[model samples]
Target: MEITFKANKNINQEQLLKLYNDVEWYAYTNDMPQLQQALLQSLDVISAWDQEVLVGLIRVVGDGLTIVYVQDILVLNAYQNRGIASQLMEQMMTKYTHVRQKVLLTEEAPDVRHFYEKNDFESCDKGSLVAFAKFG
Candidate 1:
Protein backbone atom coordinates (compact mmCIF):
# COMPACT_ATOMS: atom_id res chain seq x y z
CA MET A 1 0.00 0.00 0.00
CA GLU A 2 1.16 3.51 -0.78
CA ILE A 3 1.08 5.39 2.48
CA THR A 4 1.34 9.14 2.69
CA PHE A 5 2.33 10.87 5.89
CA LYS A 6 0.75 14.14 6.90
CA ALA A 7 1.05 16.50 9.82
CA ASN A 8 -1.92 17.97 11.68
CA LYS A 9 -4.29 16.58 9.15
CA ASN A 10 -8.02 17.01 9.59
CA ILE A 11 -9.08 13.97 11.58
CA ASN A 12 -12.68 13.17 12.44
CA GLN A 13 -14.08 11.26 15.39
CA GLU A 14 -15.15 8.22 13.39
CA GLN A 15 -11.72 7.60 11.95
CA LEU A 16 -9.99 8.24 15.26
CA LEU A 17 -12.28 5.88 17.12
CA LYS A 18 -11.84 3.13 14.57
CA LEU A 19 -8.04 3.42 14.64
CA TYR A 20 -8.01 3.34 18.44
CA ASN A 21 -10.30 0.37 18.50
CA ASP A 22 -8.12 -1.45 16.00
CA VAL A 23 -5.26 -1.17 18.46
CA GLU A 24 -7.51 -2.21 21.38
CA TRP A 25 -7.06 0.95 23.41
CA TYR A 26 -10.26 0.64 25.40
CA ALA A 27 -9.96 3.77 27.49
CA TYR A 28 -9.80 6.12 24.55
CA THR A 29 -12.67 4.32 22.89
CA ASN A 30 -14.97 4.83 25.86
CA ASP A 31 -15.55 8.51 25.21
CA MET A 32 -15.55 9.73 21.66
CA PRO A 33 -15.89 13.42 22.43
CA GLN A 34 -12.99 13.44 24.86
CA LEU A 35 -10.77 11.56 22.47
CA GLN A 36 -11.69 13.90 19.67
CA GLN A 37 -10.90 16.92 21.79
CA ALA A 38 -7.59 15.47 22.84
CA LEU A 39 -6.57 14.89 19.24
CA LEU A 40 -7.60 18.38 18.32
CA GLN A 41 -5.64 19.89 21.18
CA SER A 42 -2.44 17.93 20.76
CA LEU A 43 0.61 20.05 20.02
CA ASP A 44 1.69 17.82 17.20
CA VAL A 45 0.03 15.05 15.28
CA ILE A 46 1.42 12.88 12.53
CA SER A 47 -0.72 10.37 10.78
CA ALA A 48 -0.26 7.81 8.04
CA TRP A 49 -2.94 7.39 5.45
CA ASP A 50 -3.44 4.86 2.74
CA GLN A 51 -5.39 7.20 0.56
CA GLU A 52 -8.39 8.19 2.71
CA VAL A 53 -7.84 5.55 5.36
CA LEU A 54 -5.96 6.55 8.48
CA VAL A 55 -3.82 3.50 9.18
CA GLY A 56 -1.59 4.94 11.87
CA LEU A 57 -1.05 7.96 14.08
CA ILE A 58 1.27 9.59 16.62
CA ARG A 59 0.11 12.30 19.02
CA VAL A 60 2.20 14.66 21.13
CA VAL A 61 1.15 17.15 23.77
CA GLY A 62 3.51 19.72 25.20
CA ASP A 63 5.17 23.02 24.54
CA GLY A 64 7.55 23.00 21.61
CA LEU A 65 10.47 23.62 23.96
CA THR A 66 11.89 21.90 27.05
CA ILE A 67 9.45 19.01 27.17
CA VAL A 68 7.40 17.14 24.61
CA TYR A 69 5.43 14.10 25.64
CA VAL A 70 4.57 11.48 23.09
CA GLN A 71 1.07 10.69 24.21
CA ASP A 72 0.16 8.05 21.72
CA ILE A 73 1.48 6.12 18.76
CA LEU A 74 -0.51 3.39 17.15
CA VAL A 75 -0.96 1.51 13.93
CA LEU A 76 -4.02 -0.34 12.80
CA ASN A 77 -3.72 -4.05 13.50
CA ALA A 78 -3.58 -4.98 9.85
CA TYR A 79 -0.89 -2.34 9.31
CA GLN A 80 1.26 -3.19 12.29
CA ASN A 81 4.76 -4.70 11.81
CA ARG A 82 5.00 -2.87 8.49
CA GLY A 83 7.25 -0.04 9.72
CA ILE A 84 4.33 2.36 9.91
CA ALA A 85 4.93 3.01 13.61
CA SER A 86 8.60 3.64 12.91
CA GLN A 87 7.78 6.13 10.22
CA LEU A 88 5.37 7.94 12.53
CA MET A 89 8.07 8.05 15.23
CA GLU A 90 10.72 9.18 12.76
CA GLN A 91 8.53 12.10 11.81
CA MET A 92 7.84 12.93 15.46
CA MET A 93 11.56 12.82 16.32
CA THR A 94 12.50 14.99 13.37
CA LYS A 95 9.76 17.53 14.07
CA TYR A 96 10.60 17.81 17.77
CA THR A 97 14.34 17.55 17.32
CA HIS A 98 14.79 20.69 19.41
CA VAL A 99 12.71 19.51 22.34
CA ARG A 100 14.78 18.41 25.35
CA GLN A 101 12.55 15.80 26.95
CA LYS A 102 10.80 13.31 24.70
CA VAL A 103 8.71 11.15 26.97
CA LEU A 104 6.11 8.43 26.69
CA LEU A 105 4.34 6.16 29.18
CA THR A 106 2.99 2.91 27.89
CA GLU A 107 1.89 -0.44 29.17
CA GLU A 108 4.69 -2.68 30.33
CA ALA A 109 5.19 -5.19 27.60
CA PRO A 110 8.34 -6.67 26.19
CA ASP A 111 7.48 -5.68 22.62
CA VAL A 112 6.58 -2.18 23.75
CA ARG A 113 9.92 -1.79 25.49
CA HIS A 114 11.74 -3.17 22.48
CA PHE A 115 9.99 -0.77 20.14
CA TYR A 116 10.89 2.27 22.20
CA GLU A 117 14.42 0.99 22.71
CA LYS A 118 14.79 0.73 18.95
CA ASN A 119 13.93 4.40 18.85
CA ASP A 120 16.72 5.11 21.39
CA PHE A 121 14.63 5.29 24.57
CA GLU A 122 16.20 4.25 27.87
CA SER A 123 14.05 3.10 30.74
CA CYS A 124 14.22 5.42 33.74
CA ASP A 125 14.28 2.39 36.07
CA LYS A 126 17.26 0.97 34.25
CA GLY A 127 18.97 4.31 33.90
CA SER A 128 20.20 7.00 36.29
CA LEU A 129 16.70 8.37 36.76
CA VAL A 130 13.22 7.65 38.08
CA ALA A 131 9.76 8.18 36.61
CA PHE A 132 6.28 8.37 38.04
CA ALA A 133 2.73 8.59 36.81
CA LYS A 134 -0.73 9.11 38.33
CA PHE A 135 -3.85 7.89 36.59
CA GLY A 136 -7.39 9.11 37.11
Candidate 2:
Protein backbone atom coordinates (compact mmCIF):
# COMPACT_ATOMS: atom_id res chain seq x y z
CA MET A 1 0.00 0.00 0.00
CA GLU A 2 1.19 3.49 -0.86
CA ILE A 3 1.40 5.86 2.07
CA THR A 4 1.41 9.63 1.67
CA PHE A 5 2.83 11.69 4.50
CA LYS A 6 2.37 15.41 4.98
CA ALA A 7 2.19 18.13 7.59
CA ASN A 8 -1.43 18.78 6.86
CA LYS A 9 -2.72 21.48 9.19
CA ASN A 10 -6.14 21.39 7.64
CA ILE A 11 -6.86 17.73 8.10
CA ASN A 12 -10.41 16.55 7.76
CA GLN A 13 -11.95 17.25 11.16
CA GLU A 14 -14.50 14.49 10.83
CA GLN A 15 -11.87 11.90 10.02
CA LEU A 16 -9.76 13.08 12.92
CA LEU A 17 -12.70 12.88 15.31
CA LYS A 18 -13.44 9.35 14.17
CA LEU A 19 -9.81 8.41 14.49
CA TYR A 20 -9.64 9.85 18.00
CA ASN A 21 -12.74 7.91 18.94
CA ASP A 22 -11.08 4.76 17.70
CA VAL A 23 -8.13 5.14 20.02
CA GLU A 24 -8.13 2.23 22.49
CA TRP A 25 -6.52 4.00 25.40
CA TYR A 26 -8.95 6.84 25.92
CA ALA A 27 -12.64 7.66 26.01
CA TYR A 28 -14.21 10.99 25.12
CA THR A 29 -17.49 12.84 25.64
CA ASN A 30 -16.92 16.39 24.44
CA ASP A 31 -16.35 17.81 20.99
CA MET A 32 -12.89 16.73 19.96
CA PRO A 33 -12.23 19.54 17.54
CA GLN A 34 -13.17 22.16 20.09
CA LEU A 35 -10.94 20.50 22.64
CA GLN A 36 -8.17 20.21 20.04
CA GLN A 37 -8.40 23.68 18.58
CA ALA A 38 -5.59 24.93 20.78
CA LEU A 39 -3.49 21.89 19.99
CA LEU A 40 -4.17 22.22 16.28
CA GLN A 41 -3.14 25.80 16.50
CA SER A 42 0.08 25.22 18.40
CA LEU A 43 1.33 21.75 17.57
CA ASP A 44 3.16 20.35 14.58
CA VAL A 45 0.92 17.63 13.17
CA ILE A 46 1.75 15.01 10.61
CA SER A 47 -0.72 12.70 9.00
CA ALA A 48 -0.54 9.50 6.95
CA TRP A 49 -2.95 8.90 4.16
CA ASP A 50 -3.31 5.84 1.99
CA GLN A 51 -5.21 6.47 -1.22
CA GLU A 52 -7.06 9.35 0.39
CA VAL A 53 -7.92 7.49 3.60
CA LEU A 54 -6.17 8.69 6.71
CA VAL A 55 -4.38 5.68 8.18
CA GLY A 56 -2.28 7.25 10.93
CA LEU A 57 -1.24 10.55 12.50
CA ILE A 58 1.23 12.03 14.98
CA ARG A 59 1.41 15.36 16.78
CA VAL A 60 4.25 17.20 18.45
CA VAL A 61 3.44 19.85 21.04
CA GLY A 62 6.45 21.99 21.82
CA ASP A 63 8.00 25.43 21.80
CA GLY A 64 9.57 24.64 18.42
CA LEU A 65 13.01 25.54 19.80
CA THR A 66 12.89 23.51 23.01
CA ILE A 67 11.48 20.29 24.40
CA VAL A 68 8.88 18.44 22.37
CA TYR A 69 6.21 16.15 23.74
CA VAL A 70 4.80 13.51 21.43
CA GLN A 71 1.04 13.29 21.59
CA ASP A 72 -1.82 11.55 19.84
CA ILE A 73 0.24 9.04 17.92
CA LEU A 74 -2.59 6.95 16.62
CA VAL A 75 -3.12 4.33 13.93
CA LEU A 76 -6.44 2.89 12.95
CA ASN A 77 -7.35 -0.49 14.44
CA ALA A 78 -7.35 -2.16 11.07
CA TYR A 79 -3.89 -0.75 10.34
CA GLN A 80 -2.10 -1.83 13.52
CA ASN A 81 1.27 -3.66 13.34
CA ARG A 82 1.93 -2.17 9.91
CA GLY A 83 4.83 0.09 11.00
CA ILE A 84 2.94 3.23 10.13
CA ALA A 85 3.07 4.49 13.72
CA SER A 86 6.80 3.80 13.83
CA GLN A 87 7.37 5.75 10.64
CA LEU A 88 5.30 8.61 11.97
CA MET A 89 7.29 8.68 15.22
CA GLU A 90 10.61 8.47 13.40
CA GLN A 91 9.54 11.47 11.38
CA MET A 92 8.42 13.33 14.52
CA MET A 93 11.64 12.61 16.39
CA THR A 94 13.78 13.60 13.41
CA LYS A 95 11.89 16.86 13.23
CA TYR A 96 12.74 17.64 16.85
CA THR A 97 16.20 16.07 17.20
CA HIS A 98 17.71 19.48 17.90
CA VAL A 99 15.46 20.07 20.87
CA ARG A 100 16.46 19.52 24.49
CA GLN A 101 14.35 16.37 24.61
CA LYS A 102 11.59 14.44 22.91
CA VAL A 103 9.19 13.06 25.49
CA LEU A 104 6.05 10.96 25.69
CA LEU A 105 3.84 9.66 28.48
CA THR A 106 2.47 6.16 28.13
CA GLU A 107 -0.09 4.26 30.12
CA GLU A 108 1.17 1.72 32.66
CA ALA A 109 1.41 -1.31 30.47
CA PRO A 110 4.30 -3.54 29.44
CA ASP A 111 3.28 -3.63 25.81
CA VAL A 112 3.03 0.15 25.70
CA ARG A 113 6.41 0.47 27.35
CA HIS A 114 7.90 -1.93 24.85
CA PHE A 115 6.44 0.10 22.04
CA TYR A 116 7.95 3.32 23.32
CA GLU A 117 11.25 1.61 24.13
CA LYS A 118 11.46 0.47 20.54
CA ASN A 119 11.18 4.15 19.60
CA ASP A 120 14.11 5.08 21.93
CA PHE A 121 12.26 5.97 25.12
CA GLU A 122 13.33 4.90 28.60
CA SER A 123 11.25 4.67 31.72
CA CYS A 124 11.55 7.89 33.65
CA ASP A 125 12.87 7.42 37.17
CA LYS A 126 10.49 9.16 39.51
CA GLY A 127 13.10 9.26 42.25
CA SER A 128 15.51 11.18 40.04
CA LEU A 129 13.09 13.05 37.84
CA VAL A 130 9.85 14.68 38.92
CA ALA A 131 6.93 14.14 36.62
CA PHE A 132 3.59 15.91 36.63
CA ALA A 133 0.19 15.10 35.28
CA LYS A 134 -3.17 16.87 35.13
CA PHE A 135 -6.23 14.77 35.78
CA GLY A 136 -9.88 15.70 35.85
Candidate 3:
Protein backbone atom coordinates (compact mmCIF):
# COMPACT_ATOMS: atom_id res chain seq x y z
CA MET A 1 0.00 0.00 0.00
CA GLU A 2 1.19 3.49 -0.86
CA ILE A 3 0.87 5.49 2.34
CA THR A 4 0.98 9.28 2.44
CA PHE A 5 1.99 11.41 5.38
CA LYS A 6 0.34 14.62 6.58
CA ALA A 7 1.97 17.06 9.00
CA ASN A 8 -1.20 18.92 9.81
CA LYS A 9 -4.03 19.01 12.36
CA ASN A 10 -7.14 18.97 10.17
CA ILE A 11 -8.26 15.50 11.21
CA ASN A 12 -11.88 14.66 11.99
CA GLN A 13 -12.85 13.44 15.44
CA GLU A 14 -14.45 10.24 14.23
CA GLN A 15 -11.26 9.12 12.54
CA LEU A 16 -9.26 9.77 15.68
CA LEU A 17 -11.80 7.94 17.84
CA LYS A 18 -11.85 4.93 15.57
CA LEU A 19 -8.06 4.60 15.51
CA TYR A 20 -7.82 4.90 19.28
CA ASN A 21 -10.54 2.32 19.77
CA ASP A 22 -8.87 -0.02 17.28
CA VAL A 23 -5.89 -0.16 19.65
CA GLU A 24 -8.28 -0.60 22.60
CA TRP A 25 -7.30 2.74 24.06
CA TYR A 26 -10.56 3.20 25.92
CA ALA A 27 -9.13 6.00 28.10
CA TYR A 28 -9.22 8.46 25.25
CA THR A 29 -12.48 7.12 23.79
CA ASN A 30 -14.20 7.42 27.15
CA ASP A 31 -14.13 11.22 26.95
CA MET A 32 -14.46 12.13 23.30
CA PRO A 33 -14.47 15.90 23.71
CA GLN A 34 -11.33 15.92 25.79
CA LEU A 35 -9.53 13.79 23.24
CA GLN A 36 -10.56 16.11 20.44
CA GLN A 37 -9.45 19.16 22.35
CA ALA A 38 -6.15 17.56 23.30
CA LEU A 39 -5.42 16.73 19.70
CA LEU A 40 -6.34 20.22 18.64
CA GLN A 41 -3.93 21.74 21.13
CA SER A 42 -1.01 19.36 20.63
CA LEU A 43 2.37 20.86 19.75
CA ASP A 44 2.69 18.69 16.66
CA VAL A 45 0.80 15.98 14.77
CA ILE A 46 1.88 13.60 12.03
CA SER A 47 -0.61 11.34 10.36
CA ALA A 48 -0.34 8.58 7.79
CA TRP A 49 -3.07 8.19 5.21
CA ASP A 50 -3.91 5.42 2.82
CA GLN A 51 -5.73 7.27 0.11
CA GLU A 52 -8.06 9.44 2.21
CA VAL A 53 -8.27 7.00 5.11
CA LEU A 54 -6.50 7.87 8.37
CA VAL A 55 -4.30 4.83 8.71
CA GLY A 56 -1.72 5.98 11.25
CA LEU A 57 -0.83 8.93 13.47
CA ILE A 58 1.63 10.25 16.05
CA ARG A 59 1.08 13.27 18.26
CA VAL A 60 3.46 15.20 20.53
CA VAL A 61 3.14 17.73 23.32
CA GLY A 62 5.95 20.07 24.32
CA ASP A 63 7.02 23.55 25.30
CA GLY A 64 9.31 23.92 22.26
CA LEU A 65 12.25 24.53 24.52
CA THR A 66 13.31 21.75 26.83
CA ILE A 67 10.87 18.84 26.87
CA VAL A 68 8.59 16.96 24.50
CA TYR A 69 6.38 14.02 25.26
CA VAL A 70 5.06 11.65 22.65
CA GLN A 71 1.37 11.60 23.44
CA ASP A 72 0.31 9.00 20.94
CA ILE A 73 1.36 6.78 18.04
CA LEU A 74 -0.97 4.38 16.35
CA VAL A 75 -1.65 2.59 13.09
CA LEU A 76 -4.60 0.54 11.96
CA ASN A 77 -4.19 -3.16 12.82
CA ALA A 78 -4.31 -4.27 9.20
CA TYR A 79 -1.65 -1.74 8.26
CA GLN A 80 1.01 -3.01 10.67
CA ASN A 81 4.53 -3.91 9.43
CA ARG A 82 4.12 -1.57 6.49
CA GLY A 83 6.80 0.97 7.52
CA ILE A 84 4.06 3.51 8.24
CA ALA A 85 4.86 3.62 11.96
CA SER A 86 8.59 3.95 11.31
CA GLN A 87 7.91 6.93 9.09
CA LEU A 88 5.87 8.57 11.81
CA MET A 89 8.68 8.06 14.35
CA GLU A 90 11.33 9.30 11.95
CA GLN A 91 9.45 12.52 11.40
CA MET A 92 8.77 13.03 15.09
CA MET A 93 12.39 12.38 16.09
CA THR A 94 13.68 14.69 13.37
CA LYS A 95 11.22 17.37 14.49
CA TYR A 96 12.28 17.18 18.14
CA THR A 97 15.90 16.21 17.79
CA HIS A 98 17.19 19.48 19.17
CA VAL A 99 15.00 19.41 22.25
CA ARG A 100 16.70 18.72 25.60
CA GLN A 101 14.26 16.18 27.03
CA LYS A 102 12.15 13.78 25.02
CA VAL A 103 9.83 11.37 26.76
CA LEU A 104 7.00 8.90 26.31
CA LEU A 105 5.02 6.66 28.66
CA THR A 106 3.69 3.30 27.57
CA GLU A 107 3.00 -0.26 28.58
CA GLU A 108 5.99 -2.41 29.49
CA ALA A 109 5.29 -5.13 26.99
CA PRO A 110 8.35 -6.58 25.24
CA ASP A 111 7.20 -5.69 21.75
CA VAL A 112 6.45 -2.14 22.81
CA ARG A 113 9.90 -1.80 24.36
CA HIS A 114 11.52 -3.25 21.28
CA PHE A 115 9.78 -0.79 19.00
CA TYR A 116 10.78 2.21 21.12
CA GLU A 117 14.32 0.95 21.59
CA LYS A 118 14.71 0.51 17.84
CA ASN A 119 13.83 4.19 17.58
CA ASP A 120 16.54 5.20 20.13
CA PHE A 121 14.39 5.35 23.26
CA GLU A 122 15.56 3.84 26.53
CA SER A 123 13.33 2.76 29.36
CA CYS A 124 13.43 4.98 32.44
CA ASP A 125 14.39 1.95 34.51
CA LYS A 126 17.59 1.73 32.52
CA GLY A 127 18.20 5.46 32.81
CA SER A 128 19.01 7.70 35.72
CA LEU A 129 15.48 8.89 36.39
CA VAL A 130 12.52 6.73 37.38
CA ALA A 131 9.15 7.20 35.79
CA PHE A 132 6.12 7.90 37.91
CA ALA A 133 2.47 8.46 37.11
CA LYS A 134 -0.76 8.96 39.06
CA PHE A 135 -3.83 7.88 37.21
CA GLY A 136 -7.42 7.83 38.44
Candidate 3 clash total?
Answer: 0
Q: Report, for every candidate in turn, its global Cα lDDT versus the true structure.
A: 0.90, 0.78, 0.89
Q: Candidate 3, residues 1-136: lDDT per residue as tens digits? A: 7899998876888998888999889999999889888888999999999898899999999896799999899998989877788899999989888998999998876479888888888888985988899887
lDDT of 1 by residue, 1-136 (tens): 9999988646988889899998889899899888878988999899999999999999999998999999999999899899999989998999889988999998897599889999988888895878999988
> Model 1 lDDT vs. the true structure?
0.90
Q: What is the lDDT of residue 94 in candidate 2?
A: 88
TM-score: the better of candidates 1 and 3: 1
Alpha carbon lDDT at 80, candidate 2: 80
Q: Give the TM-score of candidate 1.
A: 0.95
lDDT of 2 by residue, 2-105 (tens): 88899976777777776776775335315666636744674798989888888888887878787888867888878888899999999988888888877787
Give the Å shift of residue 94 in candidate 3.
Answer: 0.2
In angstroms, how far off is 93's CA in candidate 2? 0.6
Error of 3 at 114 (Å): 0.3
Q: Rank the candidates by TM-score, best first.
A: 1, 3, 2
Clashes of 1: 0
